[model samples]
Target: MSVTHEQIMLTSFDEASARRALALAGEALEIEADAIRKLHARLGRDDSVPRAVALMLACRGRVVVSGMGKSGHIARKIAATLASTGTPALFLHPAEAAHGDLGMVTAQDVLVAISYSGESSELAVVLPAVKRMGVPVIAMTGKPASRLAQVADVHLDVSVDKEACPLNLAPTTSTTVTLALGDALAVALLELRGFKPDDFARSHPGGALGRRLLTHVRDVMRSGAAVPQVAPDALLTDALLEISHKGMGMTAIVDADGRPVGVFTDGDLRRLIEKGQHFGQLRIRDVMHLEPRRIHPDRLAVDAVAVMEEFRINQMLVTGDDGKLVGALHIHDLTRAKVI
Candidate 1:
C-alpha cells in the first residue's frame, strides 16, 4: 500500500466561493443591523409605541398572535414569550382560524398578526370576522403598504433590506430581524406592566429561575432541633459532637441570652489541634469564628447565596428578626433548591 499524507489527500474547492459566501453573510448582517438600528431610532421618535402600549394595557383579554408559513413560526415564538413575560397571549394559526378557530378571538382581545410580505391569503380570510368583532389588529410586516398593513389598526414595520441567504430569497436575515422585533415588543410590554421577578417566578414555578426568585431561606433552611446548636460556655468536645450529630459540618454557639455569638466547625477543630489544646478543656466560644455570616429567614435564597459568595463561606445561620438562630443552611441546600 502507498503511504499518503491526510492533508495532501484532502479535496479542495474554489477558495473564492468560500470568501464570497462569507462576504454575503457579512453584508447581510450589516444590513440587518442597520435596519434594526433605524427601527430603534423610529421607536424613540414615534407616538405609535405609546399608543400600542396603551391599547395592550387596556385589553380585557388575551393577545391573539396569528401568521402563515415562516411568519407563523415566529408568531408562535412571540406568543410564548409574551405569555411568559406577563402578557397573556396565544398563537392562532391562520388556516385553523378559517375553520372556526377564529372563535378563540373576541372583541375583548387584541390581535397581533405577522406577515413578512403583509399578503398572506389565509390570514385575510379571518380579517373580516376580526373586524366584525371590533378587535384591534397589530400587524408586523416588511411591506407597510400591503393589504394587511393597510387593514391593521397598528402597522409595525419589520422590513429588512436583505436576506442572509446567498440567493437573497430565503427567510434568513428577515426572520432574524422579525424575531428581534418580537422580543422588543414582548420586553416593552413586560416593562409597561411593571413585571417583577416575583411575578415572573409565579409564571415559571417549575424552572430554576422561579426557584431562585421565589424561594425564601425559611423555605429551605433546617430549623428548630434540626439546626446544630451549642451554648457559648459549652466544651469544644461537646460542640463537635453536636456538629457531627446534626451533620451540618458546624454548630452555632449562643450566649447566655440565646443569641448567636459565634460558629465552630471541623475547620475550627483542626486549628484547636494546631494549638495543642485538649477539646475537653476549651469552650466553643474560645475557638469559634465570631460575627459569623448570617442570613435572614425572610430573604430570598439567591440573595443568601450572594452573601455566602461575597464572604467566601459555605454555610450560614438563618436568623429571625429578633436576632436568634432559627435554622442552618448549607450550600447544598441552595443547590437542591435550584438556587445555585
Candidate 2:
C-alpha cells in the first residue's frame, strides 16, 4: 500500500520530537557527568578534603551541618548520611540558629557549612556565634576567598564549571557536587570508624537492608509444636501427618535425644509413591533422607535463604550447636518476612 502524505508528515514530526527529547536528555547527562569528572579530578589535589575528614573524625560531639535554602536541603541529607554511617550528626538551619537553635550546637561539636555562593547571608549571620562557641567549621563553597570559606578551618571546593540548567541560574550542578562531597565526607568517616554492615543496620532498623542483616533464623523460624517433627522410628504416615499439620512441606526425623537425624519432605513421599512403596508399612527412618540441610538459630535468615536456594528446597530445620532440632522454616516464611 502507498503511504499517505498525512501519515508521512505525522511520522516525521514524531521522530523529530523524539530526537529533540533524547538530545536534551543527553546534553543534561553530559553536563552533570562533566561536573562529577571535575570533582573527581580535584579529589587527588585537594588537601582540604582530608583535613575536613580528620576534623570530623576528631569531633567529640555530633557534626552540626548548617546551610541556607538549597544548601540547607543538602545539609540535612549529609547529616542523615553521617548519622547512619557512624558519625553522629544533626542539621542546623542557619536561619534557625539565630533564633535559639544555636543552643543545639555545642563547643564539643564541629560544624559543616554548605553554600555554593560563599556569601549566604543567613550563614554569615549565625557563623559568628558558632565561632564564638569555639566550634571548628568546614566550609563547602565555590569561592575560595568568600567570607564563609575564610572563616572555615577547612574549605572544600564543590565548584562546578557551569550549571546543568540551560539558563545557568538554578542550583543544579553545584547542588549535585555539594551532595557528592557530603557523601565523600560521610564515607570517609565511616571507613575511619570501621563502621560495618551491622552498625549500618542498627541505625536503619526499619529498612529492608536492616531486616536482611539483622534478622536471625530464630526470629523467623517456627519453634516448639509448630515445627514439623517426627521420631526416627515413627511411621511414614505419622511423619506425613506432622508435615501436613505444620504446613512446612517437610518433617524433621529426630533421634531419642531430640537431635535431627534426617528429614522427610513431600518430595520424598512422591518419590516413594513413584517407587510403588507402601507409606503405611514404612518407618520415617526407612524413607527419610539422611543428614538434612540445617541451620543454626543464631545465623542470619538471609543465610538460610542462600541455603534453601542452593539446595533447591522449600524448607530447612533450625538446629542448636549439638544438632538438636529447635525450629523449622519454610521458604514462604522468608518471603512473608521480606528476608528473601
**What lDDT would each prediction earn against the true structure?**
0.87, 0.91
Please give, for residues 87-185, the per-residue lDDT of candidate 1 as tens digits. 999999999999989989989999988998999999899998999999999888889799999999988888777776668798877777778888988
Question: What is the per-residue lDDT of model 2 for residues 186-276, given as tens digits with 9 covering 90 to 100?
Answer: 9888999999999999999889999999999999999998988889889888888898988988999988899999999999989988999
RMSD list, candidates in order: 3.2, 3.8
Per-candidate TM-scores read 0.86, 0.91
Give the per-residue Cα lDDT of candidate 1 at 106.
85
Candidate 2 structure, TM-score to reference: 0.91
Candidate number achieving the greatest TM-score relative to the actual structure: 2
Which pairs clash (backbone N, Cα, C closer than 3 Å) in model 1?
none
* Cα lDDT, model 2, residue 215: 95
Residue 239 accuracy (lDDT) in model 1: 91
